[model samples]
Target: MRWRIPLCLLPAALLLGAADEPQLVPDVSQREVEIQYSFTGADLLLFGAIVYPDGRKPDKPADIVVVLKGPEQSIVMREKQKVAGIWVNADTARFRSAPSFYAMASSRPIDKIVDERTAAIYELGVDKLQLSPSSLNDSAELSRFQEGLVDLRNRNGLFVERPGTVEITDGVLYRARLPLSARVIVGDYTAETFLVQNGRVVAAAVRDITVRKSGFEQFMASAAENWPFAYGLVAMALAVGMGWAAGAIARRI
Candidate 1:
């Protein structure tokens, strides 16, 4: 994962702006997730408070949007077309950077909360994800590939979008739940909260969450990564031994 400033801590330049800027205090339910053998899925609760300078809750309603993004990786999307009555790979597009997992929850519909420009800048929705290709391609072709990738990811539960899901309490504290599929990639994840007001982002926060294999899963992962050949050999040997044991038991029976 690339280095990025934590959203909870505002930069000096942004903090110097003016009064009335909403201050955010954000936190996640868990800072780390461990993937075990029986791991099914996980639900992460992101909660935060919006603090004002005067220490008074606002009368006006404020919108909140939370985004959870996993590690970024280069992905090769292939388009299959029928060739001589057989489906074959026809076109391939290599995306320079794409999130392995993405899920969002917002207080209201994104379009209603922020304008298109702000949405695009923040990459609010999965469709608005910035997936630049490694090579130059036709505009129409690139769009098709991009759409296909998003659709594919969404279908696989890697990309998710939920609007009007964030719950606000007393116009200050807000919370949202983000789900992670069992197949979620293991890496560093980011949780971002945006306070939108009048079609613009007023305050933002970012936090890091780690997803990693643990216990037996962790040992296997380490072995495979550090000693691939030995791991493969051991796995093959285990399979052969299991097969032999089963065969012997059957013969005795």
Candidate 2:
């Protein structure tokens, strides 16, 4: 009889313990790298608010400030017989500088997923060609390098200043802000993020985004969207115009 009571309790205990066991799924490949954006809109305005991680936007982004020498920047590529490969400006990090492409992205100190000490920059392609155009190399072989920097600039280099910064606490979780130049030429751009430790780079990620033009902005962006500091000035201008008109009517009265 005592054996029967213990046996009855054993079954209950087994059922209770089973609830804490981990799932023994056959495949684990379903969890892969993924990037998602919240708004499905095209044109990402220069000074507009950027929401990260679609479902979870942080209250404060641990970001970086990247200021570029827009007018002076150039992306060039060449094919050298010695290496027998196309050398892009130097190489393509996908998220860093490429011929005619400049881009930047930041991080949120949220999920313990990002390493903060590394340098992170954004990049995209502007123009590209094979080295068959420049007169510098008269040889037909030099023609390969012709599709170089000149062609990239001719496709329209952006005169932009993307100011951003990166910060992570305990070497994980991040947030950032990326601002494009109001004069940026619309195209497919790649945004990159990185993690570094003690001056050494460790991790890299690349994402593709489009800078489009549409909506009411096709005519002219409100002066505020065109320039960050100019927003205040635009408001002041409207105020001044109203004051002037009010004064003129009062004077006639």
Candidate 3:
């Protein structure tokens, strides 16, 4: 006797077998960004395509989230308090791994797309960032310092969150524009893209970006790094010369 798959179950099995995991094809507008004296800021465009299995578009649309992160740095945050009519440092918190710059953009508000746990896991928003505080063990104190650090960076345009800024076309193509502040440091950066469907991340991709100094800025940065003593001596000499020139001009006038 020959056994065969039931007609009703055959289609389901075929469909399941044919289905493949979705993939992301991501790219950035600029892979190398040069910072110069005239560098004010830049708009980084992250675009990607979602390749579905068998060219089948899902009935439900997927969400796109893009995160541009700079190199991590250790930071110390100090809380200031008014004591005897003067402001003084009160408490301090040190973070071991804090992103020097971080910006996030999403097709919709992150909270609406993913639950808190998922958001925290991926750090989809500024509030979800895991700034590892090295000094504070108290949750409340750590939270306060984290908030303060985020607020300071937000004011400086280093930490940014733009919900509903990502654009998706036909559930296949997605793009987002994130701002790079003038104060961004010269280092390696990463642009990460996440495709979310049914409150789950289905695919993810990453692109690298390099921010570096150019022209005289590059020369100075290299000099400062390679010859710190000479760089300092030159800087002090220039300061003294400028001061002397200014005084002489003033006397002449």
Candidate 4:
């Protein structure tokens, strides 16, 4: 006698045979974000599901790390020193590729979940960011400049790190929330998810997000970019008009 498996069980059998490593399916709350005149900020939800081989959760729960990174730009970092009772630029360090915005969320403190090497490789923490220095060769100088840049951006709410923020459920689903600063520049961004188990990154996935200007802000940005001379004239006229109006009001008062 010959027996055949049921159709529903066929899929399970196939998965059991084909599945070896875990996989990540990730998504972001918003694919496109518009920055208008009243734009304050936004909270982005990064969620995903983890698919393990044979549809079985590992005995040891895995960890999740989510990173939201904005476009890269070349930046010059200036160090100011008091000279003759006035602060002036003393040294400058240029970075070839530095992230305009970067925020990271992890299930636990990065040091608790992964070693320094692993953290550095994946940039799990803000301090692990790899800002490629253009010219500086001295290790100590480069480190100082990098720290200064990170500190400046942190004060501006551009670089952020939140530990113990990612929530994992049933060892299969995970979610994290990251904030977008109002000062973020318009560009393409990426939300990356990593599944870490046994101190190794098992699977990773990414979702794209776009931040753009809209309405009056969009029009102004376009005008400034496409018609620089006209925009400059308009800006000067507005400045002068505002100044005159303020002076007139002060005189009348």
Alpha-carbon local distance difference test for all models: 0.91, 0.37, 0.94, 0.93
lDDT of 2 by residue, 27-65 (tens): 111111112233231222212122233334334333322
Off by over 4 Å in 1: 1-19, 57-59, 243-253
Which pairs in model 4 have colliding backbones? none
TM-score of each candidate?
0.87, 0.30, 0.89, 0.86
- Cα lDDT tens digits, model 4, 78-172, are 99999999999988999988999999999998888899999999988888888889978898999999999999999999999999999999999
Model 2 TM-score on a 0 to 1 scale: 0.30
Assess candidate 3 and give its TM-score to the true structure: 0.89
Task: List where candidate 2 sits over 4 angstroms from the true fold.
Answer: 1-164, 216-253
By lDDT, the best candidate is: 3
Task: Decide which is better by lDDT, 1 or 4.
Answer: 4
* Model 1 vs truth, CA RMSD: 6.9
lDDT (Cα, tens digit) per residue for candidate 3, span 147-198: 8999999999999999999999988998899999999999999999999999
The lowest-lDDT stretch of 10 consecutive residues in candidate 3 is 14-23
Q: Which residue pairs collide, candidate 1?
A: 7-206
Residue 25, candidate 4: Cα error in Å is 1.3
Candidate 1 lDDT, 1-253, residue by residue in tens: 8977777667654666645688889999999999999999899999999987778765678899999999998999888999899999988999988999999999999988988888999999997889778864699988888888899888888898999999999899999998998879899999999998778898899999999999998998899999999999999999999999999999999
Task: Arrange candidates by TM-score, descending.
Answer: 3, 1, 4, 2
* Pick by TM-score: 3 or 4, better one: 3
